[model samples]
Target: MYLKGEDISFGYEKKNRILNHVNLSLGSGELLGLIGDSGSGKSTLGGILSGYINNYQGSVSMDGKKIPSKGYNPVQLVFQHPEKAVNPRWKMKDILNEGHAVSQDILDSFGIKKSWLNRWPNELSGGELQRFALARALSPKTKFLIADEITTMVDAITQAQIWDIVLDIVEELNIGVLVVSHEKKLIDKLCHDVVFLDDINNV
Candidate 1:
């Protein structure tokens, strides 16, 4: 397996478990959809898969080795709110090349013209910023991505365009993506397989 999580359970108080025995497995090039209601542990599960929350009961592994919670690389997450995920003061170029290599073509693919790189994050509209965020995440040596409701902020047309760019990048890089969303249509459109969070035992 490329990445796997088994019997994972977590909550703030040890006794109150928010996630109940969640299990998931992903191949190197799989795009898996995580669908659930608003507070059904969708973002929480994304956090676990990205190694942000490791205090859970069960096991999570990447490339068959245990996942390191602190300072872990190779995984990235794009949150639902671009403003929350991105640094308002930083330029798009800075976000992409933040001590890492980034290709010019990747920016171009996200509809970011060369001139736009010099502009701060605040200058771009929400849709543009989200696209840049996606580009930055894809710029690194990211093997897996946890996309947490990445299209919710944009209009329908922009969402379609952004999804296309993401799909293209994932195909080109052969990356695995855990796309978390409440939007069933998007999940059906992008995912190779779907994991319904409501079905905790099966997940």
Candidate 2:
């Protein structure tokens, strides 16, 4: 399967545009990196890919069909801010179980302990909360993963651990991935191909 975003144009307001005619694609078992500055609409594009933002003028398709508007999305997104993405009222176990029941192997790979599941979102640190967010996104139904600066706030060791787990799953499932980040080394090491936002975005 292939995930494709073609000629995507979006703007916050009429006077100016953030992304213009950006084109991106990731095939099964392929890893694509999107590199750009902070406000270059990298996250916005990722949002579009995952059906988070739908006001753009373009088509996002998987294997030539339009992405489903209802039901579980084949594409999943993991954001940089764990606190903003999750429901503070729910415990970690509830959060992880919202979409699907994640495997113990996945929890182990992400370094999520059984005890952490009993705590509230505030009870855990930022890094710990992020692990839950990631586990939620890594459901079995997810075929594509868009990581929008997901490791930006974590420690180096934690970052490495997450990537190690993610890469393992990517290889195991032949999952397509889009890594959106400004870090050149991270993109270089994890991605099979790279596209700078300025090179593709007409704006």
Query: Could you tell me every candidate's TM-score relative to the true structure?
Result: 0.91, 0.97
Q: Top model by lDDT, which number?
A: 2
Best by TM-score: 2
lDDT of 1 by residue, 74-178 (tens): 778888888777677887778767746667788778878877789988888889888877887885478888899998988999999999999999889888999
Give residue 136's lDDT in candidate 2 (0 to 100).
79
TM-score: model 1 vs. ground truth: 0.91
**Candidate 2 C-alpha lDDT tens digits along 5-77:** 9999999797789988888889988899999998889999999999999999989999999999898888998
How large is the C-alpha RMSD of every model relative to the true structure?
A: 2.0, 1.0
lDDT of model 1, residue 203: 31
How accurate locally is residue 60 in candidate 1, as Cα lDDT from 0 to 100? Answer: 82
Give the distance in Å from residue 139's predicted Cα in candidate 1 to where it truly belongs: 3.2
Give the local distance difference test score of model 2: 0.89
RMSD of 1: 2.0
